[model samples]
Target: MPTKKLGVYPELLTSIEKARQLIIPEDRIRVLNPLIEYIQSKIDQGQEINLNFICTHNSRRSQFSQIWAQTAADYFGIPANCYSGGVEITAFNERAVASIKRSGFKVSAKGDANPVYYVFHSDDKEAITAFSKLFNDPINKGSQFAAVITCSHADENCPFIPGTEKRIPVRYEDPKEFDNTSEESAKYDERSLQIASEMFYVFSNVKMPA
Candidate 1:
């Protein structure tokens, strides 16, 4: 089946092209298989696909996962809604935000301590609203959503997420370790593109209805 391509910002599209070229390791593919199955099952049932990427803090990894997953779904015409949350609320890190900008997303924020960010991947698409909040926050889907654990801390600590249909661990290393170092920007971008690549990989395997 042919994929339905959507319009994306030219520079972001360039990043996507690069993301598509990265090789996901076999072990990582094994880990991602469950997410693919979850999406496929939702599609097979003609149900809405909701994915909530969760981390200890809604600062970095989860945010990246949510944004990239939504983008990949859009690119593949899969109709998935993506969101991110944490066990505890902490503002989305500025470093992560900068990495996203470097990837060609246009971003705007409104707030001080914990600003809500409006991120745009395409001129025509609705902006992805990003901020620090708990996974069960009112803005997030309360039920029938897959809870994707994006960091080891959240995965282990969040043994149970109230409304998730499936809880899948897809951990990523924290770029926080590199904060304040010269490698901060590069490391954050690396993690962002890694998640982006894996997301595109997951959606690429999904088969849409005829």
Candidate 2:
């Protein structure tokens, strides 16, 4: 287990430190295995795996997936690239950003109406750059990337994603419903932890090269 380092908030560090305790159910693991296999296959081929998590608005779940996946990849020492986009351009919601912050990340936002947020999970790790854009945004990998659909709406709507080698539907419940409610903070944190736990499960299970 990694110990807390400087620049990481104490509360957020605690949240991340406890993440390993949340066990993902066996049934959910079945759904996640394909993603694991996909990453492993890419590594076997001496190729870099790029995952783009997509949603209808590029707001909550998609952002969480991208952040967690990247964090997990780094933690597991897997050479994988992670990105997030949507069917339509919309700002990465503040609620999602707040949730990630509570998980021990240092965040800084720039711009508005489509702000770009720099989310740092640790001082030594590269910061994740987040914003809203189309699925094929210029900032993302153009081809040979897996399109991970984070929301059911995006999956059903964008059936054919151009240039993607694989399309994996790993849907998650939207925490947007609890927006502005009393459970906002709790629900958002819950969703973040869920994504983080699953991502940890995925990368942790990967067989490192011999």
Candidate 3:
């Protein structure tokens, strides 16, 4: 399938290109298959694809998944709406935000605590509005969506997510472990790129309807 030419900032394009080249291990591919199947099912049904990435804090992993998933879908010309949420409100981590900026996204924030961030990847597309809130927050799609658990905590603790059509676990290590350490920036960037690469893999596998 042909991809849409995105007018994203050059740096982001570079990042995306880099992500596209990274190899996804077979183990990881196995873990990501459910998400791929869910997207394909949506395409087969000619329905909108809604994915809500859930983490314990809605601060890091889930945020990364949300941004990268949406970006990848756009790149592949797949119609998908991605969102992120948590069991509790904690705010999108500044470290995670910085990592995306380093990877080539334009971001702006509003409010003080738990600010809403507008992340723009392409000039023509609307900014992805990001913030930390409950999985059932008003801003997220309430039903007919995939609940992507991005952390073991949320995946294991939150047994049931109301209104979800499927629950898929695509857990990632928390870069929070390196917070305040010298590896903070590097670790966050690593996780962000990993998520970006994986998301690109998922969308790249999706076949558009004939």
Candidate 4:
């Protein structure tokens, strides 16, 4: 509900806006507008919007999506809460942490085996609680939520996510192939940056209140 503003530079906003127009389809753009308008109206009326990103694993894609979306929303002066979860429980992967750090986020170690993490960004520290069990955590509880599926498997298996106003399928390819590769670090960083850029596109074109 709090309209937190990051106040990015005007030139950056212009570039993000341009990038948004290129990434999203016109039809998909139309589909997103209704929800976007509603969200902005709620913000205008002092309500916070929430988005939940889901994948098969909590490590790479969804984690990046959630953090970047929150960052983008804040950068755009949108009142939003972004959370992430997975169908199977796994701690945030080490590759993700390293990549996130490279992208300018501060991370606090949450443990050893399946240790969680506190991904710190700007004025927001999203309580990025991850669960191995589906829908078994506090991150899934909210009145205003958008269910964003980042993987094909979870999206197919769990077609309907309870408590979400919109179940959006925005799938991303798994970056696990880079595992054990020579370019592991660079690959993870690439994946993280891709997610971040896509999320920036999402908020840039999202309808603001009229």
Candidate 5:
């Protein structure tokens, strides 16, 4: 059985909820509550969650969102599964993995070596394997999912996700520009932290107790 516990990173958990509270009069949480309720209820009924995060390139924003989502969910004891993909064909760069590692995540590369789309693990027994893969219904073994669009591009370009039961657009800035800069590590770490914060915040608000 999976558990949802607010772990050592309590401040980050609080930060996520705080950010949501600050997002504007409406940040889609209202409409999203029904979906959230449904997902949580499914968990109550012993269903596993599969989430997919999408972006234009599947390199940075979407990848970061997927990793952070799983991490945050794990931290909170939620048995949620996460995946990522992009609308365009782009390889997952080595620099991105370096950034993730630098951000204090254990990274592993598996699957094909295309560099654009590869599979990676977080090195934690419970952590989901993170990867840069194309978004497709077939990838998760015919699983209907909660689809999250992490960038404006993918959200705007691909509106209907065939296997998704819920589609949520939560755009984040591109960290790929920090690619070769001296600040690349810091910038990517910042993005990871940002994603981690929000995901944990959203997970925290789910009413069902573990």
Candidate 6:
């Protein structure tokens, strides 16, 4: 599929492209290559690619990873599913949601406890459904999914994810550190962009079928 087929929002396209330029340190790509290889192997076998990003709170970084990874898959014309969860359920932080909105996504929320959000990167593309839930939530695949631990705490605490084929610890710094401080928005957007950059890199590196 041609890149044009993605039809992502113009603003988001700009952001993703910019994020791509920001990915640095050749070692980071080396670190992420395993994940790229795993997804590629699944695609080569014509298997469904399911990624479950987990964090302790399921609030910020994990949510961004899910959204960006799914978007990157779509942008690359790869058939994959992305989901996010935590060890314990907590609402997707409003601050993180705000940062994504600033990044050009359209977000609509419903309910309170673990409210579901329909996040759209473009008016033409289907929205990504996001919320807080357990890693094994019924909405997520029960087996054969890669468990991507996005925080050190979750990775250390949940040593064994029951049925995951691969467990990748691709940790990120918590933007929560800056919460209620003057740097809140900037740091949140910074973290979101960093994840977005890495996700784009992963999908961009995949050897999609011709």
lDDT (tens digit, per residue) of candidate 5 on 1-210: 125343424443444454345442255456345546656876887777888888887877887777767766676567777788876656566676776665555445555654433332333435445555678824553466778888888888897778777787788788878778898877876776667656656676665552
Those runs of model 2 whose alpha carbons end farther than 4 Å from true positions after fitting are 1-13
Which residue segments of model 3 deviate by more than 4 Å?
none
Per-model TM-score versus the true fold: 0.98, 0.93, 0.98, 0.77, 0.73, 0.96
How far out, in Å, is residue 116 in model 4? 2.4
Instruction: Give the RMSD in angstroms, all C-alphas superposed, for model 1.
Output: 1.1
lDDT of 2: 0.86
Error of 1 at 96 (Å): 0.2
Better of 4 and 6 by TM-score: 6
What order do you get sorting by TM-score, best first?
3, 1, 6, 2, 4, 5
Better of 4 and 5 by lDDT: 4
Assess candidate 1 and give its TM-score to the true structure: 0.98
- Number of colliding residue pairs in model 5: 7
| True-structure lDDT of candidate 1 | 0.94
Q: Write the per-residue lDDT of candidate 6 for residues 74-184, one digit (tens) a residue.
A: 888778899988999988999999998888888999998778999997765788989988999998888999999999999999998887999988999999999999999
Q: Judged by lDDT, which candidate is best?
A: 3
Worst 10 contiguous positions by lDDT, candidate 3: 1-10
Query: Could you list the CA RMSD of all candidates, in the order they appear?
Result: 1.1, 2.3, 0.9, 4.6, 4.8, 1.4
In angstroms, the error of model 6 at 32 is: 0.6
Query: How are the candidates ranked when ordered by lDDT, highest leading?
Result: 3, 1, 6, 2, 4, 5
Query: Where's the lowest-lDDT run of ten residues in candidate 6?
Result: 1-10
- Evaluate all candidate structures by whole-model CA lDDT and list the values in order: 0.94, 0.86, 0.95, 0.68, 0.65, 0.89
Q: Of the candidates numbered 3 and 5, which has the greater lDDT value?
A: 3
Weakest 10 consecutive residues of candidate 4 by summed lDDT: 127-136
lDDT value, candidate 4, whole model: 0.68
Question: Residue-wise lDDT of candidate 1 within 125-210, one digit each (tens)?
Answer: 89999999999999899999999999999998889999899999999999999999999999999999999999999999999988
